[model samples]
Target chain A: MAGYKRIRVPRNTWNMWLWGWFLVAPTMLGLLILNIIPIFQTLYLSLFKSGAFGRGNQYVGIGNYERLIADAQVWHAVANTLLYTVLVVPLSVALAMIIAVLLNGKVKGTSIFRTIYFIPMIAAPAAVTMVWRWLYNPQFGLINYVLTQLGLDPVRWTTDPQVGLISISLIGIWSIFGYNMVLLLASLQEIPRDFYEASDIDGASKMQQFFIVTVPLVTPTLFFVFVTTIIQSMQVFDVIYMMIDVTNPAYERTVSLVYLFYNNSFRYMDKGYGSAIVVLLLVLIMIITYFQLKAEKKWVNYM
Target chain B: MGIASKAAKAAAYLFLITGAALMIIPLLWMLLTSFKTVAESTSMNPFVFFPSVWRVDNYTRVLNQNHFSAYYVNTFLMMFFRILCSLLFSAMAAYAFARLQFPGRNFLFGIVLFQMMVPTQIFIIPQYLMVDALGMRNSIFALVFPGFVSAFGTFLLRQFFLGLPRELEEASKLDGCNIGQTFLLVMLPLTRSGLVALGIFTALFAYKDMMWPLIINTSAQSATLASALAKIQSAISVNYPELMAASVLAFWPMLLVYIVFQKQFVEGIASSGGKL
Candidate 1:
């Protein structure tokens, strides 16, 4: 039996080739047809402008790219997305880190608190945005209701171009705060106790230990949060789409790049422009990802 | 645990309580609004703290009207099938990539990784055209078709498989098992937790999906819960209580799942960042 098994082993390698093909065929075919093919198709389609309805598409080459650069609305969207990322990345991580640190202790209701915090992450973006829209409603929303109770003027949370983007950011922070908190808290628990114990023996205060020992150990997870928050913030669409009503005049200020992509492609039927916009987004994401991967060596402490 | 001082514990409690309250305020307000009268939910000036009389009308109204029943069924059907297919196809491909050697493996793997990085909206326009060409638009199949398998799941599960010791497969090989047998009998079952984690991730992604569902399915008849809610939100307009009620109703399935599988739900998310 052992001799036969040894002889059969030589054939198993060849069999593995067939088995591997069999195993991966479904996903491979799906990826090629749904992902890889369409990816190139989008790129190809970008070079040509679509005609009326389903008529023939015209070759545009770099014409769409030129228009994208000149389009004021597109630039405005890029600026809005970048600015929102700047505002959200820091606050989401910092606020969540504070909450995570507070909850990492051996206290009662930690799980309960953690559960409550993660609810927004669990809910759909539509659900979260809808609720927030009600809260930010000008005349009778909960937020304005609270402001008026404080004897202050009710500010337009989702209106007034000045603060519309800010309103979106606040909602973004609130939604992501719980998610970042839980992830950071889980990573905090993974940290070894020896570092803290050693710091304690050296007479480091609790606050000092947090900065010196805890912070260094958690930097890897922190970097993960940073990359995640940055990428996600740049891609912010569902919330903006759901929250800012078309009638709400503040819509102009809060339009994100993805939102613009949707408009040019679906609403305006400017498929070429939409393709260029997304291709630009794709390149931006790739560059950002490349830099993040390179920069991880500088400060992301694995040990 | 013993290292914590009483004073520090008290401070932690205070901080956590306040933050937790802040975390839940929107959901709490949503729940309250869902139960309030329209006049109470949109009450201005004085602002009603609690409804003078709690009403169940919004729940009944939303469930009975606004095509709520169809939306609920469609969403559940899409979620169930997507989760089932994603797990199966992802695990098969992940096992092959992780364990088997084949020609062009590196190139194929690179494509999977690239798919993982691109923003999903980038896929929408052409995917919509593809679905339209297939004459499947405004159908649940189209809503679930492009996502029939997940590149992320394949990548993540491959990582899980690579972490396993080689001896498990070798030992199975000693029993005259084939590569397929080794994967099924000796390997795949061992990756249950990894599979569960990926399953939860898949479910969450499908549930929260907005743009794809909204764009692909034009009519309410084919709408998933998220798209249905988006439609209802636009159609219902500014009736705060009903909107809140619809929002809360839209959230019930997820809330129920979270409550039941709290640990998996939290860990699936806490699996950390880049889920999109």
Candidate 2:
């Protein structure tokens, strides 16, 4: 909007300016109310001891942060979230790349395969959570029944404290795979045919072309997938909340940062602590995203 | 060479078939288990894949028993308004940022970008407080409150608008059309694909959203399918068949959307990944 001189080519520019303001007002207002203002509010709420039913607020600046630092459950949730991210992020991207590369070939039923892969993405998360919870049932579950057929012991998918987080990560991997594959496939398609043809003319092996040409070309999308997946993994809530009940011994193992925020704010009526937890997540995401962006300069091949 | 090519094709088919099976089995498993009787569902000794008797009645029973039909209506209504309002606002705002030369345009757009970079979960507690203070809890407005405009949508659409030719806007100006008229009458039509993509994503996100609805709409009457299922999950602890049936019901609207707009849906994802 800054300029050296006012150069107008058309009349009624003032009216046009008003029109522009009118058109942009809704989203601007929405952003202010929904995003900008809430951020500062959450920061403010974090500084207080939330009163009865989250009514009164007695500010004890940085006290909530001090408590959160000592809170084992918060750290445990963070560790669990990071573990889930570590498990899902690389695995999802790698799986998506392999599947995308396979489907990139002029294979029979490619569209059908793509459609099938994306069906999980089509269903709501709640539905996915429900179905997986059904499958993870201890006694009557399909997975356990399958294990018995093979004469292997039925492992507790959601019940065991050791395996509960892994179980959540399994669904996380499954849900993310389709979207990542589609993106990687899109990135794969963007790789010019000339690169492959030149590699073929050079007598480069398929693996060599994949390593040298395909990977570099798809790095931008891969990086995008990586950042988004990890960020989302940090916010993992619904599946954990739905599948891991309060009675489950694995509740401690499977709780995510957002889930913990939900428990504190809504369940325990501890808004200040919940705000601190979410603020912590917000800071963690910002730092990771910062590093990702910094790394992109060296790694991501935009072209 | 011919033999190697043939082997390559076969290997590709094998890999894709296996991948598709992994992708589809859970959903197929859901549909199958939904038709089973509760006794059969819980009977691990036999390990039945299909129901001994076709229980299509399970769908009808779950739909009626848990106030699920009402929740479905509530979800669709909220989704419709959210999608409509969000699309309209995002498009207008995106066009403003992309095309108009307004004071503080870059600053405003920077704010939008900041919103995109921040995790949205941070806003939920305050958003909840706002809705509560307004006494709008347990209403559809609560569900739609925080989603009036999508930062992601505006950002994506702004990118789309930036790619449009300047000649179109110039020609509209030459014909005595103002910026607003030109945008609505001329520029808006050009971003159909972008709009459609935003619409699809918004609809999907709205449908998949669980926590907000669970928090705001405590009553099943105003709850969405996602929240309702979360409710039913805790309420009806057992009855695996009924739970499976409810999960299957949750996909019906999405199923309809997929059946109708399958190509656009796929293209939308493809282009979203490709364009950005």
Candidate 3:
């Protein structure tokens, strides 16, 4: 009986193993070919001077990186990308936090407000950019018209290099704050009402309770929103691509890493250099995320 | 409650109402501008709030002059196939990872997480080359290639499957059901909400995806709505009314569906921690 049981256990284990491998085979293969292999392939491609139509290639180890280091346009894109992230992250997070707290309170028509705010998140970014472009039109835009109505100078919304990145950041903040609000609302709901009641009984005002009880508990989600928004803003592409063009004066001021990569890879057919540029973005994101994770223990409260 | 709290509540309402208006004005403007004439749309001095004629012909003109219908069809097809593939493959892999104890399981899941961490552009150039090698560019297959496997879906569904109880599978095994039968007949039916969330996310991502469609299918005949709207923007220099009309057409389907399935959309996004 013991011998028979041992044989049955091994056979069953074998069958389960076969089924497990069979089930996972398709996704594993797809990721290997479509995503994983391509990462290494891109890294390999970055080492060469790619020919037309992906024909003959001359390998130039570190040459693309060398050029990228001295390339002013690449540095400009790096700065612009970082600046866009800086401009978008704090303001959007603060707005989202305030709105989340407001909606989390005893408020009427919370769902209505949520639906309206999230509409921008659902709309296509390309379409959103087109609408904003029309709004930013210098000659007859509603924004400029309103500015003139208020007896203020009509700022060049998209053309002026000085004001261009800020204009794009406004759209960025508008589109994303709702998403951050939703995440914050979710986390806020997780906090126990006992904490609020306790604070209230301690003679804390509404504003005091918010800072003492609400903000500390919501720090985890706040950290998440901050990190994800920074990573996403670093990859700003469609809005900048749609709003500013090569001929626009703000192109240098608004060009992001992904946009520059798109131009290099597709427009100029410099796949190798594009690969190198994207690699730089990947490394930068990893470094930033690593630091965020390390700093989490200092500020993020899991309880 | 008290006087101070009443005043605070009223203040909160005021703040929320103003914020909601600011969020909605751009979309409302898009709808209003779609019906205006060129002169009215571009009118500077007076600022047209509403169209003089409320022309419906802009929609018809955009449809007649461009490949708007083709874009609709392509976008729908892409969304359908992407959702289908993601659900099927992701469910299987997620079940394996969540339930079955297999050798190298941790190592394999690490690969999925690594893929999720990296930016998607790292895969694009080589994906383009692979599609070109297969002569599949400018086709629906090219549009749906990268979505055939989803790291995000796998991770999401694994969490759901892990939440499920193990008793169901144990009972199915005692009833003479094999692993496949237990999964399909017993376990799969229990995770309806998970599947729905994944489906919603896949569809939303597929709809808003511009870069892949733009790069893979360059021609208007095969373009998605997002990319086609981009083409219209670039093709016509200053046709504000027509451009607004195209924007309206491109986004209204999503907005309408969102209105109808508002709860699902909100819960799907909220629960999954999904971003647009």
Candidate 4:
């Protein structure tokens, strides 16, 4: 056994402190200058009236908010976003949970199945969207091809306003299911084997075992997956952007809040108003997450 | 213990097999379609999984037309530096949070945790403005610099580091090593699993990323493979062959990484999801 002693901070140790701060400083500083500061800048920009090239941003406090409240398009985008969240979160979580449960069985080639499911999770989003676009094509697309084989009329995916959001949401559902499935599967594995063994001893059927044991045990992971899915759906952009042609007639129905933010900031260069919209989106996310957390406590089983 | 029970097990296998097949069909279809000619690709009544006559030219055409080589190099470089920076910063911060009794450590960690909930979307506008102000647009740095710090990575690593047994650090201290030395030698090796977990995630997100690169890198040469894959659409008449070939190439590396490290990767993300 070696003698123990608390090492004193050598004079050079201040250099270590300085170096640690220095190493960590760029990142924290970047986050501040780039992220945190911009958050405030966006808030401030929201208050201002924009001029050409986003220059001469004059202050008109709450004026932008007033305009936004009265703006139907903003509300439409909000509704579209909320609808997307509603569509994606539950669909993603439930489907993922079901698949995870199905996979939790001591089946052969499970790892291969897990890999197959996770392919969409890693594939380039734009590429995946393009493939889906091809599939969604009413003419000569695989989806319509399949539908026609089933003797159904071809559905115009991105072009038709009625089915566009649903079509986009379908892709969203496909892409995210694997990630959630793996999450739930991990949670399901954590469930003590004894729980199932005991349930089986008590004459529980497979379904009952799932309900009484698996469901309760995996609720914590399920809640996590749910909250994250909701949060992700609310902020979703890449799929919608790549899937829906912004110039098409269906744009009105498909434009998400982030897409609208992108349009305002990049396309139109209405930086000030765009900033305002982002701030509002942030506030909305925070409030929604708070509520989700409160709700999770009621149903989530931490053990 | 009867033949009837054996039949039930077989049914379970059948259900799982169908589910697995459904999951793999799109990928298999994409691969098969990539080898088919334009006529075969658009065929309505083509009851063919394999191409009647394979055209290998699509891969060549996509490679020649797009500056794909440059994009691959740039994307990989971005991933390498981004991962390196993220690991270093996150580990250092995590170590401080886990082991050090510094002033305002918890408060600082709280700030990082808060930042995780604030979506990257909200930060993009302000981040973009700053990048524009710095005149770093269309540069690789613009693509990789902002991503160097990850709140989630720091938080996850902190959890892993905290869960580490303190005995190693105590022994190292007895050997007259300082905090930095102990962290470098003892703690770092002990937390290898967490590091690998962080690495896989960093690599996955960094490589698959499109939004930031799309916004930041306007020049084709500087853009990533993910961005390069989008070039398939700009050319008239969907070239399924080359497009699928390119998509396959783009999808292959990460797929290989995941397959190679499936156990660690799955376990890492699963546990991280639970903790975070």
Computed on alpha carbons, the lDDT of every model, listed in order, comes to 0.84, 0.87, 0.89, 0.78
Name the DockQ score for candidate 2: 0.73
Model 2 TM-score is 0.96
Quick one: best DockQ, which candidate?
Answer: 2
lDDT of 1 by residue, B1-276 (tens): 465687778887888888777778888899898898877776675668798878899889887777777788888878888888988998899999998997777888888988888887777777888888888988879878877988988987887788789999989999989888899888999887778888887888888988888888888688888988888888888888888898888898899999999998787666634322
lDDT (Cα, tens digit) per residue for candidate 1, span A222-290: 887888788899899888888876676887788999999987888778788799999988988888899
Clashing pairs in 4: none
**lDDT of each residue in B1-276, candidate 3, tens digit only:** 989889988998999999998888888888899999988998776778999887798899999889887898899999999999999999999999989877878999999888877989999999999999999998889999989999889998888888889998999999999999998899888877788889988998899888889988998799999999888899886888888899999999999999999888877767765321
Across A177-233, the per-residue lDDT of candidate 4 in tens digits comes to 888998888888888889889989999998898888889887877787887788888
Q: Which residue pairs does candidate 3 place in steric collision?
A: none
| Candidate 4 local lDDT, residue B53 | 77
Clashing pairs in 1: none
Using all chains and alpha carbons, the TM-scores for the candidates as numbered come to: 0.94, 0.96, 0.96, 0.91
Please give, for residues B1-276, the per-residue lDDT of candidate 2 as tens digits.
599989988888887888788778888889898898888887766668888988787788887778876888888888898889988999999999888876778888889889988988899998998999999999989989888888888988888899899999999999999787898999999999888888888888889999999999897688999999888778777887888889988887798889788889888877777444
The reply for model 3, stretches above 4 Å from the true place, is A1-9, B1-3, B274-276
For model 1, the superposed segments whose C-alpha errors exceed 4 Å read A1-10, A52-54, B1-8, B271-276
In terms of docking quality, how is candidate 1 classified?
Answer: medium
List candidate 2 stretches off by more than 4 Å. Answer: A1-19, B2-5, B274-276
Output the lDDT of residue A33, model 4.
66
Question: Which model is ahead, 3 or 4, in terms of TM-score?
Answer: 3
The TM-score obtained by model 1 is: 0.94
In terms of lDDT, the best-performing candidate is 3
Q: Which is better, 2 or 3, measured by lDDT?
A: 3
